[model samples]
Target: MPRRIVIVGHGMVGARFVEEVRRHDPAGERASLTVFGAESHPAYNRVLLSTVVAGGLTAASIGLHDPDWATRRRVTLRTGVAVTAIDRPARRVLLADGTSEPYDELVLATGSRAWVPPTDGLLAEDGALADGVATFRDLDDCARILELGRPGGRVAVLGGGLLGLEAARGLVGRGVRVTVLHPHPHLMERQLDPGASGVLAAALGKLGVDVRLNVMAKRWTPELGLECDDGTTLSVDAVVVSAGVRPETDLADDAGIAVDRGILVDDRMGTSDDRVHAIGDCARHPGTVSGLVQPGFEQAEVLAGLLTGADPAARYLGTPLVTRLKARDIDLAAVGDPLVEPGAEWADASVEVLRFEDPFRGRYAKIVLRHDRLVGAIMLGVPDAAASVIQLFDSGAPVPSDRLALLLGRALPGEATSAGGPVGSPALLPSGALICRCNTVSKGALLTAWRAGATDVAALSKVTRAGTGCGSCQSAVSGICDWLAAAEPAELGEGAA
Candidate 1:
């Protein structure tokens, strides 16, 4: 008999695990699988929630799984069902409805929940879930915020991290006056350096967002805005908290599983109990919790290899601190560290320090280097350059011989390709390369759906949810429409034109 696997928490990680399992073991009689999710729908993309709030995407475009695909694979997907507890004694999981199911091996992909730090009056009179106070962790949260947001809404996003900034941008696109409360010295302190942060802060300020740093929310008055540590209050419509996250580990701990910051697992993602495994945001491998899709997919592939009677030589190292913020009209990506101490012996840069700051153009870029090695850099405007930089980083290409050629309106001689990209040209188009760091959809995927008969942006919106949440990618999606039309002019008709 094939091993029976039960996975809890159907977010990106859980859903991806199932996909890998089916792909590795296409003959399902070899391995039976079932996934239990607390949400109402099969895993949709959480990264695109902000876009949905901005009216650019619908529900379908962000969905990652298909019901018919699951049925055809004989994968049982149970949504709207919560697993209350895991009865390890019986090796079965107890559901909220009191039914119990047995599993030869259990995988806890419970994922993390947004950390809502304790604050004052964030509750109703009886301490119920507050109306004006919600989180942006899932699709439901985005839907609630959209329902509450109106023509003239006032919103305050707690936390200046990626999600917090994305939420603020979405609310702003909805015509809501938005304020971002961050406890750090600068926004995205983890990704961008001080110089880059300054550029980003200035850019956000120009967009009318109130960027307050080194400020912590001391309390939340649902009627008012957030009360900061300095007694200054930010008055707004709703308090959307993106304060960070704590891994969901109650079940793992209760089962006598070892857990530190998260459920402790080895490189193989096998927890203390050999019979129990974990992946995604919840599994704290010796390496950091990447919190990105790529690492989680890596974990799934490794486990899938082990389950399929393969040697399973794969081991996850860790994900670089990469930030691709999907904010309104912004394209920013940073890998490794953007800010290093002054006089640090960094990689060589063949290009001179390219500086472009035009308040009129709303663009700023600071590319740092040693000879031609990309150590760290930041981009304020000129999003088209992001892909080129990523390509350089990936290929480990040496910088151009002429240092100044890296500056504005300059491309290394003979480096320009047919796509008009630099010599290495990430070859990934800005439209398809996931300019919107939020949803993470490639331009190719969007075009595929369009050519497959999805019509109009709205219809495309329903299929891809590209511009739904943040509106930053709206223009990018429009560009994709043009690109698609140019490729197949006859099919798109006036819609593409």
Candidate 2:
């Protein structure tokens, strides 16, 4: 008999786990699967919700699976239903509809929920969002926000984090007057240093996003708009809250499972109970620095391998830290820990700090190296440098000796040439260099897929999921497509496929 694997929460990571499991046990000879989604609709790309808020893409365009995907895979998928309880002793899942399903193994991918701050009047008596207040969490939030944020409307976005800034830019793009109220002194304090944060705030200001720093939302009422602790009231039609998120660990907590800030897991992503495991935002691993989709995707792969018995020795060490802000008119990528101080004991004698700022040009670059390795960096307004720096950072290879050129994005490793070619040019990246961090697609992988007849960007995305996550790597994929099309059919490495 096949091992019964039941999954909870059908967010991006949950759906990905399903796909990864199918890859190993395509014929279902080893494992049978069932997935439960709390949301009524099928899983869509949550990373691209910011773009949906920006109006560049529709809700229908970010779907991860087709209508008959489950049927074709011979898997059971239940959507718009809640898994209320996990009967651990019975090895079954109890649903809210008074039904239960048995499983030999339980995978938790519950993800997270938008963290709404305790601003007065923001929540109704029934604990729902008060009128004129919404979050930028899901597509449903996007629809409501777009309907209320009509052109000429005034909206107050509470928070200056990545999500807030994206929503603010989107609202401003739609001709809605936007004001970003951040409680912290700078935006994205966790990802960016003060210098980089300053440049980012200035760029947002130039883009018509009024950013207010070092201020907290004292109270929020539809009639009075938002009242600040600085004794000011900003009258607006709506409020979009993007403070942060808290992992959805209620199910794990309710069951007799271990949970900290998230569900605690070991190297194998197994919970305290060997039969129960967790991944994604809901699962807390040692090496995850931030709550991006990449780590979750990596975890899903590790769990799928172990569950299917394809690799009994497979273990999930951790995911490297790399975050990209998917906002228009601004290019930003943060790798490792860019906030390391020069005077800190660990960084004192060994670390080499370098920074170059050009606020007039809206550019800021900072790199912190220790022992000839690219340890940390914050690249802003420099897409070329970001592309190459991210490559060097991920490879853990020695950076080029010419620090200035590397900072300016004019230098690269020996294998790749940078002679006037765009930093995003496929020729300038080593074959193994990652072009898309979302699906972990590499330049070599794209070439292999192209040689195999997935020639265009859309086809490439369909086959390899290169530009599917946040759509940040769409241009890079397009550049690869153009280069492949212009070159001879068998120019170089045509047999890679």
Q: For residue 23, what is the lDDT in candidate 2?
A: 93
Number of the top candidate by lDDT?
A: 2
Per-residue lDDT of candidate 1, residues 313-428 (tens digit): 86767654445677767766665456654455542333334555665555666666645666556666655455455545544577555544453424433221211122222123
Once model 1 is optimally superposed onto the true structure by TM-score, how far is the C-alpha of residue 311 displaced, in angstroms? 5.3
Clashes of each: 27, 1
Deviation from truth (RMSD, Å), model 1: 6.0
Cα-based lDDT at residue 195, candidate 1: 64
lDDT of 2 by residue, 1-497 (tens): 99999999888999999999999999998889899998887999998888888888899988888999998887899998899999999999999899999999999999889999999988999999999999988888999899889999999999898889989998899999999999888999999988999999999899999999998899988887789999999999999999998988999999979999999999899999999999999999897843688888888999999999887788888887878888878888888888888887788677888898998788999998998898899999987787778888878899888999889877664333211123344564677777778678888888888878998988998888887776777777887788888866555453422
Model 1: how far residue 487 lies from native, Å = 9.4
Q: In terms of TM-score, which candidate is strongest?
A: 2
Question: What range of 10 consecutive residues in model 2 has the weakest lDDT sum?
Answer: 414-423
Work out candidate 2's RMSD over C-alphas. Answer: 2.3
